[model samples]
Target: MPESPHPPELPARLLADPEMIGACRRRDFALVFRMVKKHAGIYPSMIARRCDLTPSRVGEVMAAKRKLLHMDVVERISDGLRIPGHLLGLSSRAWESPPELSAADWEPPSRPTEPPGAHSLPSHDVGDILASVACTSPRASTVQALRSSIEDYWRRDDQHGGEALRPAVIGQLRYVEILLMQSRGDTVRHGLLGVAAELARLTGWTHFDARQFSQARLYFGEALRFAKDIDDRQFMANVLACMSLQATYQDRPTDALALATAAQDHARAIKGTPRVLSMLSMREAFAHAVLGSRSGAHAAISEAHRQFERISDSDSDPAWVTYFNEYKLTVDTGIAHARLGEAEIAEPLIAQALHREGGTNQRGRAFHTFWLARTQLQQGKLEQACHTAVNALTPASAVASERVTGHLREFSRQLTPHRSEPAAVAYDSRLRQVLPAGVSGPPPP
Candidate 1:
């Protein structure tokens, strides 16, 4: 089949993938084809038609029965499929010639534009930074734009992982750091501090999701410092809560408890919205549950539920804390109960959120699915657990967060004892496809 006039273009994020780059470097077209099919939606037959090969040949190549080492065929795929020639180790393709070439005959080299959402400062930009610091103050509009970008980053992070946006965020954080030092007069600095605090906290979150513990803690501390400098108690409590969450994930439940307790205590002084208090109480509950303090955990959970009941339309929550709602509370409550060895109670709560969650947080859905599966499995419902666990892969497949990946891996480990069951076997077959290469499982022959 000949393709439509417009060929599919992989998103910049997918093209920037390290795995994709490695496959291209190794000339591993079978792997490359699989990745393209997975990410770009260009299947074997379409690939063959686009690259001027027989469908059977493309199938053979994908099945590893054939290889594409010939230069002419490689160039054909590059041009016909719009892959850059350099991606295949060849010289630049004809399409890459300035589109202006045919009409203008010649032209001077133009400034190269960075890929979308990317941020970096070249050596030449240092003077500009200093000049901006020395001359202009950040305007209200500029402050609003920064805040808006922070919100977008949060949404993007929730949908997937931090791999794609981390660079841009870190770049922005550095820029913010510079401004924080240079901007001195007026309420603008306070606003900038709040923004810096959030950006630093966000940067830390990206690292934490990737399992970079030390770096995560460092940024969390940096966030807290920025918050403290301005006496932003609510934001400080938020960062402490984040640190507590990280500690919980790192398996330091006692440390997590200390952090969460401190946050809860500090947040009380603000007597902020019920939503904020509910969130802190939940974080406290999580730590207590992890520490096996059933009484303490239950107490905190009760407080959280009570706070949730008091939430009103006019309640004011800091922008960052607005994501804490009844749905999230329910999910966390269930998870906390699970940690407390109450799977029977946990299962229903988790199942409700798993089915009712309306947001596009694929990673969150995957996390909930894993927890629900684990709870079901704990109750000896082997077949049901396997079915529920397998459903996680669909959502998990779309996100690259190490946290979600860790949940899937833990669920896999839990299923190890039942590996030979037919349901487990079925689940494993699909699971192996998405787990990163060189993970716990061996490479296929």
Candidate 2:
């Protein structure tokens, strides 16, 4: 680890005082800096230079004008002040000598009352005598690594199936939860929770795709709680939209519409970015279509499109919702129309969407192809539907998604009435030879 650029000449008296550690744990940076100024005669500008932050930002934080603590900022402060990471609810700081803790310093202020299995595990000391291990303090780099890991797992879940990455994501969630519990300072605490919320939401999505509805709901709820705590309306609305989507998939149109509406209402109340508004409106369209409200659905979809049009790629947006685009809107519009039984309208829209972007998303291609096939079948184009369904199988087979399999199963059911037809016969034969088991096909290869 690199040495601090501006190590404070902290006196032994100040270092030994429990109040200083208590202030750190409480995230009283202003007080902490005041103490530094009093003892070491260092000014905030000097501190800012040492911490690699702009003087204005440091001044804002000290004056309590800025309360949002980011992980990078926390690392700078910890490194500069020579504070142990654990003192501020962080893991052990790798750069500095571990702070000496008396027995009184080791105990937490208080423990929350909770039933067995409901409480968090005890916090581990950096060098616990019982554990005989040295834990490094959490670094800004560590948070960045975790964010990258989550993104990789997300991409893996897209290409592969949730089952392949489920255990690992769950483990990551637990690890993040531990970090949230242990992290002290505002910057690190908020940053860890923000990342953890995203992880929870991703875990919930994987579970939902895997048909683990109960587990999916649990994680979504966790994500929502964290988002709420952080006052992140966009993330909170996003989670609600996910829940709405799950409800729509389960055929609970009323619940889906309610959730989506709640999301939209909250987004508006927060004056969220156009991208956020667009996402919520799109979700509302899905629910409206599911409920057989064609005009309402179309209106919501149009609003979504308008909101999306207002957003430019260069505009500042949250990382999670950056995937939204014109092509996605087209695909969603097609889905909404399909749900409303407008096959003719849906077919062209879906075809256009696939033509433009199908090559990029294997899972999405499988999903859209299944829908296109369904729409063809709805239009009585049995031969064309069979071909489309066949095109879907390869990507569907490559992924481990229960939702994709469900689509294939529904397609099979629609094919049953036409089974005696030559095209249907060929499809069945091909499906039986190629598709995974329990969906009227051979087991996955």
Candidate 3:
């Protein structure tokens, strides 16, 4: 017989117990499932494959939607997990006895502070192996696979806008959700939830970038739930920070402030990574700017700078946060200043950021370019502003970003007062020609 990829990781005593096998045979699945998860370390997806059952059927059984009454099914379960057949009321001769367990081997590892509803599998570090006398369980290869896929999609989204990858991302998210439901063991489950949270956050951010507010909010809420389930305070703060950014763009300063404050509270409570802390603080600064609180905005911006400086090369950033760097901070700070009518201060910072990371990110370039043009116009450089603003339309036309469209529309409206001027008329006509058809009327401020 082929060896199972997910061999039982439980101690020999638990595998020999009739009660455990009886639970599986009788289909008290939740009890059996938890025992399998805690003791065997075998995920349900693995079990379904071994038993030649569909994943949905296995889920139904686990969830109590279906019963495990058939003798053939019971036999399959016993054979699949390599459970001793006699315990499942099969012939004793039909199965080989599993290895015996010593009294010392029966003791479960100590995890006194394991949070309720959040299980953590044993750490993969060699220290864990050397520290415990217990046999090593199979490492969760699936977790690493999921994490790789998530990171891949994230990089794709960064290079190309989400429109090309959003559907595929959503599909991957749905698959991850299934894995989450099927997952067993604390470490494995928590890892799955972490991946889910990151994917949810990415999906939300993509939708937000595309100007699909409702979908973005839905995914953000979904991400928040997963983060909360695992009590991942840092990731929760990340999701809230994203929510705050969406609110700021939607012109809901009060909502933006509330969400940013909530994110900061989480960051403080957890003493989060410096990068994450900096991001939350930056969001807070933007919120303050939107609310027209100059002193508050400056205070938050200074804090953001401090937090960003605290991020050292040795500090490891989580996959979701590696994108937050000095260039991003500069752009964010400049936008906050620009939003508050500080054109002179905003222009240089924005221009520097544009000269740095803006070329690689079309969406980022479009956003900053429009703001640079706005700052120029604010400083009464009408001709220069018109030309710079026109340059932004190149990316705006190519990308399916609502923020870019909104910026173009706003620039056109700002030029309306100077409509009779040759430069303004030419810029206005260029904006109209560059914008996608049917996007008429004023856009969100």
Candidate 4:
């Protein structure tokens, strides 16, 4: 069969079943495929044709011998099989049901309630969010509403972590993408594109914090695409800077350096604001530090400080770059020094970062505290390091960040030599409750 224009929709009854909902929620293709065959009479070959999977792959999935994880593959399954995207932990699918209209929930300037994924709101269906997009006449208002919702999502992600926010965020992004497809006027289309870009970037950040690197790259790439479509040079630089940061985190210093440099090249074209330049400069510094180039790292870090000092007014800085202020700059500088093995220099700056970071920023605290502990250890202050590592446990346990957890594991391994010391024993007791049973201390590198 030449691929059907759209996959046939499932019976209304199958779509509403609680078991099917639960399976989709978990993204369990095994269970989902089995259910489809049993109830919908859609055999494996038909599934292969619709979802663009080979017959063997479908057989393996049904036999519990394969699992689907890539974002693109997941998208195909969602769109091809007529599944609502959010149910499968995705954004709204392309083939979502016809404009099932509902009132847009939040008005402009009002903070949005928490989204689904446990902490999420009760009503997260994309139909509700798309209600505003139907107002073609008031394009500016629609764009403004989209921007406001994104701002709220960012605030919540910054205060907590992004793991729980993915479902809602991706849901919004999908609605934006769908709107972008149908947009008419240049002004409204550009506005929607900008909104889509920001949402994609935020979604990528959520994935990055969870240590889901592959998925993060895909969304970041999507953000770049949206930004380029609008010829938004500044936004492109911003996404490049973000990609550079992700590369640095993954220990791909060369790729990180190239991406950061490309972003700085774009800065000349855009005449980027002081804060944006500083943020990009710091990304370069991170790559330099990873590459063991102390001179290069220090030069970029100094430039970061210099550009940041030139800021005329904090008011003019966009929300995207506003977080790259004093505290963030200090933390990044300290992290660069720590990577260069200058623990004495790193300790003070990291301490200040931990001190200035807000109480609600649990994930940030956990991350900074992990670095602080490591720096203390590098100075041979075993007891102090142990105590500092223990301090991170409180915040780390409270947040659902895989990156922070990995840092804690690395810190635990550093304490293996002091495993019997009194302070270390105290830390061990606390860590036991926080980490998995068999992984309190990871195998040495």
Candidate 5:
């Protein structure tokens, strides 16, 4: 067979134009200048001489002041720098056209404009009203809409009306897409690594959510591999923590302890921020607790508390790991306490976690609720335990997470003796709703 021929290189003009637009949009001057230098083969000093500006001034224009350039100035720069004006989308002829145009005119602006309603546009100007509403509306509305669409697709699958694999495959594809977007250009290495780390985390998480534990292990392993490849100590530590979480769910407490300890070691290897250290220590505490090691667990919890105490409100932390705050730390510490049979300490900590405003995501909240229910059961608050467990099952049912369902099964076993009670009956009904049909039996206590 003949060797495959190399792919054709993209035109410099085509590549540079998009980079210029992207840099302008993102306020990324360095990238804009670098692209100009690379594609145009013109030095800043040379452009400076022709444009009647100092080299440093030219640098500023390329980086920060590109937006400040008037159409005429841009034209002058393009001409003087030997860059085609058309490449910059600033040709004099294009701008000189009559204000009113036809379909054949230059491509219409890409931004969406409000279309007339069925009744047609009113005489009054409505642009201000629409602008005001757009400004006040949450930016997350877009994300929420996308999430809803995805859930709807999953709903179709749930009802046997769509491909069963659709949701999982789409989720995995989205994670990869985000990873690609975050990796391009001059993105900060640490920042890019964080994105890749998150992609892997979510890939694993979604599989874990779908109750595919073996598949989840594969994704989590890939994520840990990327985390290590980036040599980002903090990210690696976080990955280790996630590994421990997966192990715990799989009922391999020994593996959980080892992974959590590795996380602590990785965190210690670098001069990590307090936030990273707190997460590592918390995971360590959880691992030790699960393994029934009280002293080790308490010591890790104390270290986590100390580290958290040192974090100032204004400190700039990585977004992915910043969620590990005092509330979360307290919740994990409570888990440690619960495993150690310290009901008093565990109950209050778990309660505080539950009450705190938006301290966790949907999944985390479900897990915490499960734990609270378990603790309540242990403390003989059967009614309250059942209520909490049912509440946990409600959200847990929405997603196919084996981890959450496992907790439900455990709660069911605890409720078995009280099966005749109303609360236990309700709990059993909810558990049945979430579990697959014919799975058989309540979960082990």
Candidate 6:
């Protein structure tokens, strides 16, 4: 299909304010679908299938009859149709509840503590330093250094700066923002497009780190759109892969598969680099495994392995795909196999993965531990399973992923036969400690 024409850029003033930019990012389908129909002349059926939605449902969304949408559905339509999400007015921050009180009503209490040594700079002093840096260096490196300085100030400030740091960060962000805007202006230029996409992705990661999924999704969607616009299939695949991970966390395996499949198809159609293809295929395998399609999952996984084998030390993969390799793929495969009740095969793969130097992310380690616990439970090793479950619960409690908690809940159910045993008691205690209120006990035997 021919690519859709890029929309006219928003005015500089409009993009200056975060709120206005956010609103522009969260566009409504009423507008987007109309534009799609006008530009591509594609019927609703084709759009629905590409987006994995029923034609009727697409009609509802297009008609504005439905006010709510699943994130994956929005992502699928955006990516599949090449519609920039920012044009749809989908801001990540829009979903948050409004502040409870006006600024005047919520006056700050008098500070009792002394100011920290590093944060003692007067507002004027900080402003002057920022101005000097901007005047001297117009490049991104300088802007980033200034941003880092402001962040350090915020971190060290005892006062929390109220609204003080806002203006400074906004200034630094403006410099970086200009760099991104210039890059976007030359969207067809490969180097410019890469810079713009990287900026959006980093901004999205910042939101993700702050536990703002809604905002994170918007930035990620924009990054994905720009990546595709530039015909950077590898970056596009990476963005889709991240979206698939979000779907898995949200407990929507079907949506995950749809995203992974799109990524895989795009990778293959574009003859993407080996590393990109491998990552996409691995995601496809994971989605299939989640849906209990064992043979399909195994085939997809084997394809991924084959692609990885084709890679050479001299060939460079995208920076984002660096974390994916034999060890990670094996762990993912083991999780899939365990879910399929192939404990004998799953256990050794998982053991090997654990034996390797796992990544530094505590949450990932906790998830791997949970998968191991599941494998043990399936093998009827109750005591061993319970021990693994306790380890999983420790780090799992620190992370907000519902998938980890769900797995622990399932393991608890599997241990019901020995509920009164010491290991079962310990497992139940851990579950109670981590689970939300009113979560019922596991299903009866």
Best by lDDT: 4
lDDT of 2 by residue, 1-445 (tens): 6545547546878866788867776667887887887887768987777766667766877887754243335656777777777665455665654356445457767645342121232233321332332123555666788899988887787788778786666666667666665676788777777887888888789989987777788788888878887888878889999999998776557888999998888888877788888888889999999777989999998999999888966767878887777788898889999988999999999989888984335678899988999999999999999998888888887888878876776677567668789988888777767775456532211
Model 4, span 159-182: residue lDDT tens = 778998999898887677667667
Which of 3 and 5 is ahead in TM-score? 3
Tell me the TM-score of model 6. 0.58
Error of 4 at 324 (Å): 0.9
In model 6, where is the ten-residue run with the lowest total lDDT?
Answer: 115-124
Better of 3 and 5 by lDDT: 3
Give residue 176's error in model 1 in angstroms.
1.4
Give per-residue CA lDDT, model 1, range 330-399, as digits (tens): 9999999998889999999999987789888888888999899989999999999999988988888888
Error of 6 at 33 (Å): 33
Work out how many backbone clashes candidate 1 has.
Answer: 0
Clashing pairs in 5: 29-63
Q: What is the lDDT of candidate 3?
A: 0.75
lDDT tens digits by residue: candidate 6, 69-130 = 34445555655564445443222222122456445447855445443111121133344454
Per-residue C-alpha lDDT of model 5 across residues 1-445, encoded as one tens digit per residue = 5322321223456446766656634334356556756775656876666544557656766666533322334444544544444444433333233457644456745555454221121122333333333322223343334345445444443333222443444343344334333343333434444444555556566666555666667656666765675677676777778878776555456788898888878877887788888888887787777666889988989998999988987766765576677788888888889877787789888988888837225556778888888788888898998888878765565554445555655565557678789888786777677656533242322
Off by over 4 Å in 6: 1-175, 182-196, 202-216, 397-410, 413-418, 430-445
Give candidate 1 misplaced runs (Cα > 4 Å).
Answer: 1-135, 440-445
Off by over 4 Å in 5: 1-194, 429-445
> All predictions: root-mean-square deviation over Cα?
16.4, 24.1, 23.4, 13.5, 24.9, 14.8
Write down the TM-score of every candidate: 0.69, 0.69, 0.66, 0.69, 0.56, 0.58
lDDT of each: 0.79, 0.76, 0.75, 0.80, 0.61, 0.61
